[model samples]
Target: MAPVSAPDAALRFVHPDLDRGPEAGLVVAGDGRLALATGMLAIRQSILMLLSTTPGERVRRPDYGCDLHRLVFAPNDETTHGLAMHYVEQAVATWEPRVQVIHIDAHRDPHAEHVMQTELHYRVRRTGIEDSASFGFDLSGGGG
Candidate 1:
């Protein structure tokens, strides 16, 4: 699917300075400053951030996370994979309203020791363009 290019739509999904520069999330322009992230990039980053977080990891937002790490301990099987897909679907639906989840796929890595891969396909609510994100989680050390 064709993704909408940058600098086109109104500024959306503005995020904190993630560059980790001196100003961190803030960028300095000639006249003023801004925190980076626009359009699809911002939405993508937001999804990754949500995925990276473990539930209760955020200080004040206890319910604002993916908790995908729990799959690390689960037995590599279709049931586990199904649960993972459902979990991601629910989390994304609750946490991010800017995009509609089209499909979710979770599967075990047969070649790897203990790894699970999750693919999420989505369509931007405003643009109607499609995009996807893939995540690989290592389950060896943490749980299984």
Candidate 2:
């Protein structure tokens, strides 16, 4: 039998959903399914970071609560998007005054989740806040 030719290095791994590997430098359009999962993960991480920074005195407030800030991954679908937006708007109106919001992600999410967060903190200034402020220690690769 002839020796087997090695599979194309680039095509060796195929995503079950994608028949062709993405072309070089081409970006995949964001998928609603992936966005929903990623957004949830990012929101969860943000909340955890917020809680970790809370001073011991502030943890017991009865009025304070956390919820998934709802959002629609589909922009043109009004019935669904409107419902999602309405839910988030109501939650924001109810919760903004009681709790602080945090965003933790490598790349900013531009969907409904991030939009609500942006509006929530629009007035707050991040002037002196370093990227490492929330992380407790600066991991910037620079000498002292």
The most accurate candidate by lDDT is 1
Q: List per-prediction Cα lDDT, in the order shown.
A: 0.73, 0.28
Candidate 2 lDDT tens digits, 1-144? 243322211112222212234543223435522112122222333333332232242457543332222222333233433443343334434543323333332222244222212112211122322121111111121110
Instruction: Write down the lDDT that model 2 would get.
Output: 0.28
Best by TM-score: 1
Tell me the deviation in Å of residue 23 in model 2.
28
- Over 4 Å off, model 2: 1-76, 98-121, 125-144
Worst 10 residues of 1 by lDDT: 12-21
